[model samples]
Target: MWTYQHSDFLVHQIPALENNYIYVVADKHSDNVLVIDPALAELVRDACKQLNITPSHILNTHHHWDHTDGNAQLVAWYGCEVVGNAADTKRIPHISKTIHAGESFDIGSLHIQSLDATGHTIGHIVYVIDDALFCGDTLFGAGCGRLFEGSFAQMWTTLQSLAALDEQTKIYCAHEYTLANLSFANSVDGNNPELQARIIKDTQTRNMKLPTIPSSIGLEKHTNPMLRALDDDFCSAYNPGKTPLEVFTDIRSKRNVW
Candidate 1:
């Protein structure tokens, strides 16, 4: 095994399933890597070999096929343990550890805490390790997950909890929806300069074809309109005469078509 250095967590932005992102987190210090929502099994394997590491764990954030589609293949190739939301047992393949909220585990030196995030799915989880957050489809840079299997209330509360993490936490959301989401944010919050700045930043990143992810929690709090559903000023500007829930529902509906 190769000796490890600093920042063992290797992030590979796999653009697949049409804009979805699947990250391969490897800790070289431990000679182990955890595949978070492996979009493709071969992709995960190649990523590990690229860094001379092996897959020890497969973490699924939700039961979505885009996220867990590589489960069986990864597990078979490396004999990794597949851990996922306790509610996704039957749907997602190879989920060996069905976890719940507050469940904590370790992969070598790093500690992983599972926070149940319900908006995306009943058992959708946000994995917290040190100052990093892997929030699958539940939370994005400028947007959030749809009410596919959960409710607005659940989504709102879950997002609030995630926001409470350290401001410096690197939020690795599982999609490349930032630019599109930021566009919707600007349309909804026309007067927000922070939103404008984000749009410009996103454009530059895309122009360079660079990864526009792993946004800071602090930045998301300032610019993400979806996460500001409770701000009275934001709500009023979003929909002049609508209630908070109405504003949220309206924004969500419009973004659905955007």
Candidate 2:
């Protein structure tokens, strides 16, 4: 488990199920914590115990099994409110509250805003709490999620929305795919100095068995190939005279096989 602290929230990054990440965000003042994408109940339970905090809510970014597998168990154990995208009520288990894009809520003193991130899944949503973005599989460190139930245009639009956020916002995407994603990013934008530096830095971090997550929007904008689909260089190479959506489609298709 890796821990990161914001001004009023504490985030725990729990590694689970191969490369998946389950985040536990707690309010510093109230100790009210919300579990994000709890794939493994035991890991979440153990982390809560160690942190001396109990979960008060569960936030699901999507309906994927890996993201919501422990939702029922956690809710049963904590009697917590489960929040998920309103459009995915049928899919997310034990969801108590359905939220939509631009909706804001309060957990203790922490303010959270939900953004529709529907490319990874049709009803995918990301949570923005303070400076942290609890983006599930919709976005990754150096890449974005596969278009499982949405279109390339949807994914591209979703990513563009995230890219427009505060550059310093820490992206808490729910996966440990930095190394692999950066490798593919290197292939796509090989000439980017920032990307090259990130490849070396992330390689060392992975070699040392450390987590390379919580990447900033600024860093992603500078190095992430998926976010750079609109760049002139990227468009020249992969899109030619095509639109950003067309370039994004080609990049995503290539990543599917990569």
Candidate 3:
């Protein structure tokens, strides 16, 4: 067995593409492991070796280069099944299982759930395991992926689904945009004490050369101005008299340029 019945899963954060964070999940009892968004295959492979884990499966959240750049290499190395959104096999190149939203699978003792999130990109997806969510480029700690393939409405709905998860879920988003996103949050909602406090914490993380990731979903709900669309305080600070969606639009725009 790669993992004992009660062993907690392990995750490794691999930095890439200016700020992208790739993840690898593994079972501790045995050598089996699964790679998520293998942006750097060799690094992922080496990391697995150092941890005494062997990659036998891969989950790609999207077809973006930063997410799937190492797919071919990793697949060749592990003979792993490459999983992704069914609608994106043509673009993804190595998708062995074209998974749908809500599909379930097993990785060691963990039962995984796939959530389709089409906002940053049309085929963007987030994978959930236990209390950890591998949200490729959809929901971030304090921001969201750019509207590269879907509408704000789509992203909005997707975020709501993620928020509906258990409050303690550790969100492993795909990038290290916390500092930049927090900067934009402060620019728009400086009066929000929670948001302000989060910015301080994010700064401290960066100052310590630590990744401000694996952020809890509950904290994101309270401090992420982008995620607080319905909050009157957040909306009022950004647009003064704008509708909720308008406020959301403006906040997104500033984030775009941030």
Using lDDT as the measure, the top candidate is 2
- Mark the regions of model 2 whose C-alpha exceeds 4 Å error after superposition: none
Query: Better model by lDDT, 1 or 2?
Result: 2
Report the C-alpha lDDT of model 3 over 97-152, residue by residue, as the tens digit. 88887788876677789998998889888899888889988888788889998998
Ten residues in a row with the worst lDDT in model 1?
Answer: 1-10
In order, what lDDT does every prediction score?
A: 0.80, 0.91, 0.81
lDDT of 1 by residue, 1-258 (tens): 112122646565566666767777777467777878888888767666776778888898888888888988888888999998777788879888888787999888778899989987888888997777899998897999988989877877798888889988888888888888888888878688888888888899989887678788888988887766767788776667777667777777788898
Error of 2 at 80 (Å): 0.9
Provide the clashing-pair count of each candidate structure: 0, 0, 1
What TM-score, computed on C-alpha atoms, does each candidate reach?
0.91, 0.97, 0.91
Which pairs clash in the backbone of model 1?
none
Model 2 per-residue lDDT tens digits across residues 1-258 = 899989998899999999999999989899689999999888999999998899999999999999999998898899989998889989999999988877999989989999988888899999999899999998899999998899998999999999999999999988899999998988888988999999999999999999899899999988888888757777877657888788878888999999
RMSD of 3: 3.1
